[model samples]
Target: MTLNLENEQNHELPSDCEETARQVIRQVLASENCPYEAEVNLTFVDNDEIHRLNREFRQIDRATDVLSFPMTDWESPANYSCLEDDETAAGSFNPETGELLLGDIVISVERANEQAKEYGHSLKREISFLIAHSMLHLLGYDHMVPEEAAVMEQKQEAILQALGITRDPEVRS
Candidate 1:
């Protein structure tokens, strides 16, 4: 698995924050048991750029925290059609290096920072949740229906909890 993180805009994100993000991503890749080599892009942007993307792609004309574009063969629930299965096992042969590109995830720092405040958590927790959520989306996991969403939510929570990142009240023992 390859992680390509690019910060084009002027944002002074801490090094620790970026490392933590990468660590979470690595764990996800390993846990997924993805056989073929994969490449993913992580981009950080501002509210304006993310809003434009939301309007253009989703046509919602609003801002969002994260956006994922998966380039693979995927056929699952109809409502989550926004995802394309990048499953290397599904005969999605990457012609070039026989490696699949698992699409991109763009995050709005502005939104994450704001949400952390609203959620009464650190920016680190918010970023971890966002990364985990988008990674699940990349793997074609969705909450389009109640059942599917519950499954995905449980996985998300499990991953976060394993990483010691949670939504629970602080456990001061």
Candidate 2:
């Protein structure tokens, strides 16, 4: 998988933030059994930028911790069979790299830091959690309802746990 990451914000992020994001994305894809070599774009932004994005794209006036913009809509999460059959399949693959273009993820580092403090967790854990959650969305997972939310929560926790990142930094399983 190829991850194109850009840090547009000036926050003092963790030194290993980029690697952490790559690891979380890989874990999510592995857990979902994604079939293709994937490519994704990740951008870190400040709260103002995120707030603008949230309002423009989602019509939400408030800023969120993370935003996911998936390239394809799937019948089932991470099922790439439909893409293979699609007439636009040629457009889905990266021209030079030949990897399936997953989508773009925009994260608000300022918001994540605030949430980490509010939730009593390390910044690394909070950022990792956002990456995992956004990856699930890119794979077509949603939390519109309780059942879906539960599934997403479970999957997010599993992904983080696999990376030894948890809500409580003192504990790891």
Candidate 3:
């Protein structure tokens, strides 16, 4: 697995954020039993940048915590194709690693920090959850429907738990 992380925001993010995100991505991929070597590009942006993206890509004029742009057609959790090798395709596989370029994950650092305080958890935990959630999205998970949301939530919680990231007690009860 190769993770390409970029901080496009001016926020003072944790120095270890990139490593944390990589670990979360690995855990999510392993839980899904993904067979192919994978590569992901993650970008950290501020609310304004993410808001612009949400408007342009989703036609929603609001900032979102995270957005995922997947590069594959997912047939199932276990079966999916990296973008076609044709140059006409949107993205290509990495020649050096032979890893499928999974796609990009954009996160709003401003929103994440606010959420961490609102939810009474560490910033690290919140960012880890966001990365896991975005990875699932890249791997064909959607939570638009109740059933799908339930499953996605379960998978996210499981991944976080496996990483020893749990809700702060004050936030829980």
Clashes (backbone N, CA, C under 3 Å), per candidate, total: 4, 0, 0
Give the residue spans of candidate 3 off by over 4 A. Answer: 81-92, 169-173
Off by over 4 Å in 1: 76-98, 167-173
What TM-score fits each model? 0.80, 0.95, 0.89
Clash pairs of candidate 2?
none
Cand. 3 Cα-lDDT: 0.85
Give the deviation of candidate 3 from the true structure as CA RMSD: 3.2
Which candidate gets the maximum TM-score versus the true structure? 2
RMSD list, candidates in order: 4.9, 2.1, 3.2
Report lDDT (CA) for all predictions: 0.73, 0.90, 0.85
Candidate 2: list runs displaced more than 4 Å.
170-173
lDDT of 1 at 117: 74
Q: Give Cα distance to truth, residue 51, candidate 1, Å.
A: 0.3
Residue 2 error for model 1, in Å?
Answer: 1.2
Give one digit per residue, the lDDT tens place, for model 2 in 125-172. Answer: 888999999999998999999999999999999898898887885632
